[model samples]
Target: MRGNHVIAEAAIRAGCRFYFGYPITPQNEIPEYMSERLSKIEGGVFIQAESEIASIHMVIGASMAGGRVMTSSSGPGISLKQEGISFLSALELPAVIVNMSRGGPGLGNIAPSQSDYFQATRGGGHGDYRTIVLAPNSCQEAGDLTYKSFDLADKYRIPVLILGDGMLGQMMEPVELPPEIPVKRLPPKEWTITGAKGRPSRFIRSLILDPFEEEEHNWKLMRKYEKISKEELLWETFSIEDAKMIVVAFGTAARIAKGAIKRVREEGLKVGLFRPISLWPFPTKILKEISRKVKHLFVFEMNMGQMVEDVKLAVDGGAEIHFYGRPGGIIPTPLEISRIISSYYYQKKLG
Candidate 1:
């Protein structure tokens, strides 16, 4: 199945009953698939919202009504949804958002690019809230992570983000569907403001004017983030124990890094790859431990050194960190990454 379709199917299996999205390149297949499948379900709703803002709000409203909801978009659409996302977080809503990112500071092309790293991982919306951002490198993970994103959002009572690039959304690869996992529905809509019955009405607002109240709310959200950092920092490591150099990457770049690692290994160079599955709760501790054993680190991304800053912070100047990648819609190839590894080895030998 196509990667986007895998995500759409996984959303259905995960009990997402509502999907609202605007058509965008490299990820339009998700909405297209949902439009077909959602109609078959008894109470499912799929809407091609007039705009990204409406799409995000529609999903958030559905989530507040105790329905599993989702939305997908690219870079520009994501920017438009930021306001609604911030509001959803402020209300502690549970929904999954997928950003099959393209290039840009603004209106970049529909080619695969990880340039949205900072925006996705570091709270693109206003205020001091964080989204649980998962970065999947393969089509299989694209499906699996979409399912997991719903659970994470519910677990933390916050929006979760599945961050991928065009390659992950557009590529086709074999994916094994998980066994029939039971869909966990939200608790009886007691907390939701559906309507005032015999009980008191509920309000879902993020406004707390008092500094003390706002501080309290912020601290509660922070505690959730701290727990997530401890429990959900996921990553995959390959050939790094005795490696002379390590490649730090995520999403599509990580896939290319794997090929580059293989090529350098065949050439008798001790290189390895580290791919982060969770971009928000980055695997900083693991990278720090690996840094102690490696002399050099190379960070390959689809953007200009966004994640490299985190890598450098993790290593804390213990190892040399070098970054190489293309900006905008350009993607770095395996051969180019291999050459970078070879150049690092040459420089080390000369030194």
Candidate 2:
């Protein structure tokens, strides 16, 4: 199945009942799949919102009512949803957002690109906030991560993102769908504005007019983020022990780098790949430890050099840092990446 369809199906299996999204390229299949499947289920609702802004607000509303909700988009559409996302975070609402990212500062094109790394890692909206970001490098993980994202969102009562790209969304691959696993455990939504039927009324708003109250709210959010950083850091490493050079990449770029690392290793170069499965709360500590053992590190991405900054901060100049990338939807093939590494190695060797 296509990655978008797998995610949509996984959401259903994970007991997500409400979906609100605007149609956008490379991800329209998500909404299209949900539109057909959700309406047929009992008590399920799928709405094709008029705009990305409206769609995100609708997600916020459904989540406030204690519904498992989701919305998907690409680059520009994601920008439109940021304000609503910030609102969700401030209110500590649980929701899932998928970005089948395309190349862009504007509407660059409907091709895969990882330019939104900074936007997703740092808060895209206007505030000091963080969201749990998951990067799935394959169609299987696309489905698997989408299934797990709902749990993570509810566990933290914050937004969780499944960040993919156009290529992953459009491509098809076999994925083993898990049996319908009912969402049995979720933090009590005692704060939900279901009704004032028996007890005192509750409010679900991000506003706290008093200065001290607002500061308290921010501190509370930070505490949750800190706990997440400590307990939820996830990554995958390959061939790192005794390696002289390491390649760091994420999402589709990581998948490609795996192949590149294989090619380079076959040529008897000590190289490996370090893939961050979780982007935010990045695996910085692991990178720091690995950097101390390697002579050089390469950060590869589909964007110009977004993740390289994070790599630099993590490595902290423990090793020589290099970057390789192509923007505007140009994907770096395994052969191309291997060749680049070979060139750099030979140049340094001659010098």
Candidate 3:
């Protein structure tokens, strides 16, 4: 199945009963699959919202109604949903969002790109908040990550992002869907709005007018973020024990980098790969640990360079830092990456 369809199907198995999203390229398959399949479920609801804004708002509503809800889109459409994302953040709602990003500053090509790195890692909307951003490098991870995203969302009571590029969404590959994850595994969402029946009326709010109350709320959020950082930072490392250089990448770029690292190793270069599975609450500590053993670090990405900044901060001058990237939807090939690494190693020797 296509990766996009895998995400939709995986969401079904994860007990997501509501899907609200608008149509967008490279991700149309997700909503299409949902529209076709969700209705068959006993309580499933699928809505093809009129706009991205409407779709996100619909998700917020569904979430309040105590349903596992999700929405998907590309860069521009994601921008339209930022306000709602902020609302979800402010209310501390548990919902999942998938950004199958295409190249873009504004309505860019449908080709694969990771230009939304900042938007996903940083709070894209107004106010102080963060979303747990998960990046999947393969079709299998796309399904697995999408399935797990809902649990992370509920765990944190915050929006979680499955950050994939156009390549992952459009590509096809084999995947083994997990048996349905029983909802009993997660703690009950006692805060969700079911109704005002036989109990006190419930309120779902993001606005705190008082200065002291708002300040306290922000601190509470910060404390939760700290816990997530400590507990949820996830990444994968390859051949780091004897590596002289560490290549850092994520998502599709990481997939390509793995091949590049393998080829470079065959040429007798001591290089390894560090792929961050969680972008926000990034695997900084792991990078630091690996940096202690390597003399240099390189970051490869589909954007001009965004994750490189985080790599630098983690390395903290312990290693020489370099970046290679192709912006505007161009993917760097394995050979191209190997050649660059070769040149970099030789240049260091000469210096």
TM-score of 2: 0.97
Q: Is candidate 1 or candidate 2 better by TM-score?
A: 2
For model 1, where is the 10-residue window of minimal lDDT?
180-189
Q: Quote each prediction's TM-score.
A: 0.96, 0.97, 0.97
Clashing pairs in 2: none
Tens-place lDDT per residue, model 2, 65-184, is 998999999989999999998999998999999999999989999989999999889879987799999999888999989999988998999999889999999999999996676655
How many residue pairs clash (N, CA or C atoms closer than 3 angstroms) in each of the candidate models, in the order given? Answer: 0, 0, 0
Q: What residue runs in model 1 are displaced by over 4 Å at the alpha carbon?
A: 180-190, 196-198
Winner of 1 and 3 under lDDT: 3
- Give the Å error, residue 149, model 2: 0.8
Question: lDDT scores for all predictions?
Answer: 0.88, 0.90, 0.90
lDDT string, candidate 3, 1-351, tens digits: 899999999998898989999999979999999998988877789999999999999999999977889999999999999999999999999899999999989999999999999999996899999999999988899999888888889888899999998899989999999678655564577888888888899898888999999999999999999999999888998998888888899999998888888898898988888899999989988888888878788899899999999888888998889898899999888989888887887777722
